[model samples]
Target: MLKERVINETVPIQKIYDEEIMKAHFSSETLPSVPLVYKIQPGSNQARKNLTPTLPSSSSFDIPDAYQSTNSDETFLIYDKLVSCKKRVLIFASPK
Candidate 1:
């Protein structure tokens, strides 16, 4: 039998934060002034539901041109993608 994370009411208890990690991330000079941390989640449907699709400006929506790949010196590590909050990822705010 496969183990599964059951969320009856979706009470998130696990924390994904570390102090030393944050210190290193914030100190990086090459990083952007305002870091763009994309909220990646389990559901693939969320992006399709929340955001409308847009065609590339270089190409027409009806055109089927082979996408040209550009080489870059930039490198992104798993550590760079990570984020640490003061506490667990708990959104206490609610809408009326």
Candidate 2:
């Protein structure tokens, strides 16, 4: 499994779900309209790292995973926000 971290300034959830941001990953044909979103509580679970590669002698390793407003209607249509850190994750909405 891959691991990512989210930190720094917290952004409002609404802005994170913008269409322009999601368009590349989800075309209208692929994304569900008004997908469900569950708010995850900020806690230690987020702190859990499955694996962190040991660095030789790095001073700073503060970068966190991409923080995203996730879709949670038992669907794959995921909308996340990443500015400059352009790595993207695509989730296709599940069929009901």
| Residue ranges of candidate 2 with Cα displaced over 4 Å | 1-6, 19-25, 33-35, 39-96
Per-prediction CA RMSD (Å): 22.8, 17.6
How far off is residue 1 in model 2, in Å? Answer: 15
Candidate 1: misplaced stretches above 4 Å? Answer: 1-28, 33-35, 39-96
Residue range 1-96, candidate 1, lDDT tens digits: 000211211222121212223545665665456323232223322433344345545322332111111123222111111134322221222122
Task: Write down the worst ten-residue block by lDDT for model 1.
Answer: 1-10
lDDT of 2 by residue, 1-96 (tens): 111222222334334434333654777776675443334323313534323335535333333243223233253445433434545444444455
